[model samples]
Target: MSEKQAKKERTRKRLTQEEKAKIKQVEETHRLEARALRENWLNLDNAALIYPAIGSTEWNSVFRLSAIISEKVNCDLLEQALRDTLKRYPFFNVSLCDGLFWHYFQTLSTAPKVELETNYPCRPFTFNRKNQIFRVLYLDNKISFETFHSLTDGGGAMRFFNTLLARYFELTGVKYKNLGDFDLNVRDLPVEEESEDAFHRFANNGKCKPRKETTAYAIKGALENPNILNVVLGSVNIDALKECAKTYGATVNEFLSAVYLSVMIAEKHHSNTKNRHPVKLSVPVSLRRFYPTKTMRNFSQYLNYEVPTDRENASFSELIEIIKAQSKNINIDYFQQMFNANIRSERNFFVRILPLAVKDPILKFVYNRVGERLFTSTLSNLGICKLPAELDDKILNYHFILGATKLNRINLTAVTFKDKCCLTFSTRLSERRVIREFFKMLTSFNLNVEIISNV
Candidate 1:
């Protein structure tokens, strides 16, 4: 046959038995993968539903969790650790997709990648990316894990990071015993409890009247470069901070909240204003503490604390007392009320049936207009992180930071490990006044704080 005719004959050749078998095998693999993906998919929970509805490039709800180790990060080992870690958390490696009526998560077949840390924490997440919801980054001695808020709260993120770190150490030939839930020997399976939608499990239909919230006096300053967030991380002695809290008859969170309120009040003092408007602050209370749920999703509520500055000369002591009292009222009933208010709204006959394409705009409007204006700033303390005694010495410290929102320029987050407490102030505005006063107040209380700022 001529060369052209031979080529045409080859192209028209039918498949052999081996070729047919290979094709069938490939098709079978794909079918299995598709089935697994479908089985792993989950609808967004009650608390998580709002995040995708309102998240934007400028105001995404994302946060960062970091672990500082004694030695520099081993990227190769870390990557392997990530792959192994992700196998156990099928839910973590998910890509979010929009449905006609809601947003849901689909488990990804691709593995999570670890890269050298270069950018700031809490970059926007586009579902189209290879890894949708979270990124693992390493720089020198620090390994940082940043995730979309809808994926998990700080508590959940911390557990994931701790496990990742422990697994990384294991890969690096570090002998550590009792690796907790991160032991690779554990079977790679999703815990039913960990992936549950706890809010739905605990929510009640009991209607709590929505309380009126006044627009807070916003902290004004020259806006920083559009997307850049200024971070000021202060490492304080945990014992000293606890001692200071004890002196004031408050917990560390309560004391810190008081300190933040005082700093806001001090801003007015520095500006020489006698205006007595209340300084409002919001503190996120984890629902896991109230309800017994192992879900690693967003299961937290906020306690909005307002110190009535209308009282002439509201002292720090007075603010602490007011904060303490408000905190006492944040029991199970309070969270149930908060959950009911949210779930009830979502359960509205019209809301549940509305198409997402149409519902997103309305939700965004409500979040921006009503919710965003309620609190001037937020403080989320993940509290003390515990690890096995064997692994504790190799790890140095931990830090948590809440990304800023459009109306709320500044937000604070704290997590303690070992003897050190890492308190991070993340701000979008180009003003250092709030953080500066915050650290100064801690120092004035005789708690020495080593301050570092990301310019």
Candidate 2:
């Protein structure tokens, strides 16, 4: 070794007395602060309050965000990246803890384990003791993040995932020129607004009227084993899909929602079960654009597009027109009302004082009887995802997959990256007819589609 290198190693190995004392002091202070955090608890946001009460051993609201990197992932580097990423999102380093009247979050004593992917995606958290609500898994070149819905909505999860990718890319020495455009740096510290309950912040002052929910027609099929999750991904050119949507005089989201409703109608017709109810697609709209916030938690609401029973036989163009008419709800005021309705209930004296034992069963029953029944299926489009220019070809693809619930046997999610739009369908139904029909609709437009599956 060179003389300069040998001297530097010697200095690192043998710290001076002053340096040692300063290091010890810093360590002690950090230890105390961490200890204090371990004892403290955080309240579940207005939307997340029901998850702890309603989540079951069989099913829970889980969502996954994944990216297939161009090269095989280095496990050691991915682990290091996770540790560094959590520092800027301390809220993610937490466990769901049960309390007397409500459930809460507590920072974990240590970080969560990063493991190799083996089991099905979005497996239920045992929640035996201090289990974190989120998990990170890597297999081959793909890095997948699965989290309980209570943890964060798509906007929050995307930021966290993108930040981790930025750090991972930096570690791999690939610098992206457009990295500053999004400004999601892993080196930054946590800010107060990142953990704020934005639902409460943007709620309207007046008692907003909550819209009546429809008891929509449900997707029926032979159930697959509860232990398994089936995911089918269909990829198409974003430009081609957009052109098709444009052909129908519809936006991408409206076009997709219309296609989903058409599938539900066809399913009903083929089954002949005589379910003539409205087929509703629960479309989750991110509130970040309307009510800006930096909170890394759930802050999105659903816009139900219920197909009018009278117009059930309408052509695809007619369905698109129907959806376009309902697009009026895509506004600040509509979401404000949705937010207000939930926040007001949370503020109710009775709900606030109820015991956990009494609240849990009631919440579960209400969720099953109301929430699940109000929507036939869900269609969430993450608009368009942008990454740094250098990372354009570095990421092979992206997928946004939702977990299976008992009522909604199949759900669809879409995400676009670098002009490639991936439409992922996750389901527990062994029946693949609906999936086939959905893709058939796409191909009928002469759009070339490549399919992938983990059935």
Candidate 3:
């Protein structure tokens, strides 16, 4: 053999040793925790307790978050990356299971399948042993992750998604130069607190406050196909949105919420419905800011904001202040009350002793009757996502999509990356008035809004 071939052989062996050394580093740190987690069964996190009871196979509680990369996805490399990445996020390597009284997550000793992206995003997932609660999908230049709400919320899922992207880039022989907001070294291990139930940890046993009772008006529209979730996506300049919000002395989320409420109010008037019920917006607030913990589970509380029925005719500026006032009432003390109420109900002796068969129906009934009744629409702003400079060149943009619900058919979500903010509307309804007016309103403010894509 030539001397050049011998040199190449030695370099390949050295690279293999380096990879093994990195694997050993992670195993040394995570061996004990990973072993225990796989052997144990854990109760659903506080915010997730109702999902199993409420979800169905046809429309299970799931949300999709997709990132559009500049390059096409390589299936073989993605599959290999998933295997290595799961080692860092072993908690996500679990499946849904049932207990005598409640549904739980049981760690799996096996790997999950990665699939091609479906035409419809946020496709239903099963809550049984047959399938994992989350899936990784790729199509063309896009990579989408659909997860069971019971598994994690947007924040947690975003971190996992970002890590997976970073790993995928690494596997493609990209230089490990900048990791900006991600801490995804190949040897990083899961921290213990990342798996804890934060709501229980932060619960204060105060008096449980009774939630306000008011039925919000609903949107009626022509339904799409059962297998389809209609998605409308728009991109706006982050600076332009920020400036527009500043004119009203509001944050970007507050301004968007007000716009959403304003549109619904207009829709109500246009429909000529005399119900005159309060049109409320359910705005989800991430609890990570108020707390010190960083658990990769559902840890958010939503604030229900509405224009008072008496003030229904109030102008757009007034709605902005109204949302701001409602937002101000949200802080540690407010979340504590929510935790108290939720835990108080969960800890009741009757609730605890009930069988799963008996409790499931009741939970679903409460959700449909009380929970869905309170909000006309839902909006979750996952704030801006930032990746390393290198990744910025490879990843074009990010978007968040909330799956449609029965009552809240037209829901909104926005995610920003760098200078672009993508606003996505997910609904089963074919009617486009509210969605059309939403963009029209943003453009009315002299903001440049463009349609990104639709599904």
Candidate 4:
């Protein structure tokens, strides 16, 4: 390569921060203020009903959202930034109150403190008595936000984290002219849209589809410190993953889901489990993609794809085929059916008339027998995180970790940024067979897989 040609290539690749700011100017225009309203006692949305009934010290239904920035975290600045961010997102700063018939939310008068994290990810929320549903942690150069599932899902959590980052940057004198979705200054309004219950908005009084229950293959091994969470983060090259998925004619999620199912089947065969059942993967489908709403609450549903264990020897292509077809069918109509099912149950006269004490155990029983038994595990992909050029350069990467459940010991989540797709596995059981075989399969596909474990 000639020096002149090399110089030209280098110049094109290294974009100045100012140039980065100008590149995404059009996206900055999409930012608009939202109209917000204050409410003391608000009803739980359709999706949040089951969480409280089944929640315990062990299965708290919480998740953690963390970011790796270029500079060290400043606690003072983060504290103030959170105070300001909560003003705009008041729905998150509330405590759960038990009602006669339902669990309601009451806005807290005081704000929760931001502390440095010294514990494992997805710690049980009941361990603290502050009554706040979410808490922020700072360590080294990272900022972590942990929240109960009843408060929100991944989409809402991302909004809060992004907004907090933007405000922190401003406080540190590093101003971002426009951070795209990460721009905190642009969405500075108390908009009702932010707190809207989207499931209620898109549901109807249609006959709910009766869900069929089937036993799925469960992973069993030494429980080992059952309370401890085993985390393995695999950073895969996005370009290579995309190319591999392209050849299979599947999305990244579909391809990874297939890969995950393959690992589970292989482990089952290795263990020589006598009775085999259908292997089901619980995939969360975000409702915001279909119906437009800015509600920062739980507005997502799960789509379970089951492959019979008798067909454990099926080719990767065959497993992916089933996944692609099932995932594609989860369209607007499918979501409506799911939303209506829950709404129908909530609207039932007998169910509504039942006392809270009577309803809790019934809901818990149904969840254990049907809900928890329906799927083998969960694979949730948060799509991709895109930020303005300057901010993107400053961020090392982002992670999404779902809390492990009593029935479902392992849960996997993926989020992409720039060229890296971070796939995180959170589990409670001692067996590393599933996670070990998962990355091995990725390497078999000739994709570069880097593993980082927080055990």
After superposition on all C-alphas, the RMSD of every candidate to the true structure, in Å, is 2.9, 5.9, 7.8, 15.6
Error of 1 at 258 (Å): 0.7
Clash list (residue pairs), candidate 4: 34-191, 35-190, 35-191, 35-192, 36-190, 36-191
- lDDT of residue 354 for candidate 4: 97
Residue 429, candidate 4: how far off, in angstroms? 1.3
Return whichever of 1 and 4 wins on TM-score.
1
Candidate 2 overall Cα lDDT vs. reference?
0.87
- What C-alpha lDDT values do all the predictions have? 0.83, 0.87, 0.87, 0.83
Q: lDDT of model 3 at residue 244?
A: 94
What digit string (tens of lDDT, one per residue) describes model 1 on residues 39-153?
7778888889988888876668889998889999989999988887787777888888888888888888888778787777777777752556999999999999999888998
Per-residue lDDT of candidate 4, residues 336-444 (tens digit): 8877988888989999999999999999998888887888899998888876665765679888889888788899999988899999999987879899899999999
Q: Each model's TM-score, in the order given?
A: 0.92, 0.92, 0.90, 0.89
Which one wins by TM-score: 2 or 3?
2
Worst lDDT 10-window in candidate 4: 30-39
Q: How many clashes show up in model 2? A: 0
Q: After superposition, how far is residue 43 of candidate 3 from its true place, in Å?
A: 1.5
Q: Write the per-residue lDDT of candidate 3 for residues 48-111, one digit (tens) a residue.
A: 9988888887887789888899899998888888888788888888889888998988887677
Give the count of colliding residue pairs in each prediction.
Answer: 0, 0, 0, 6
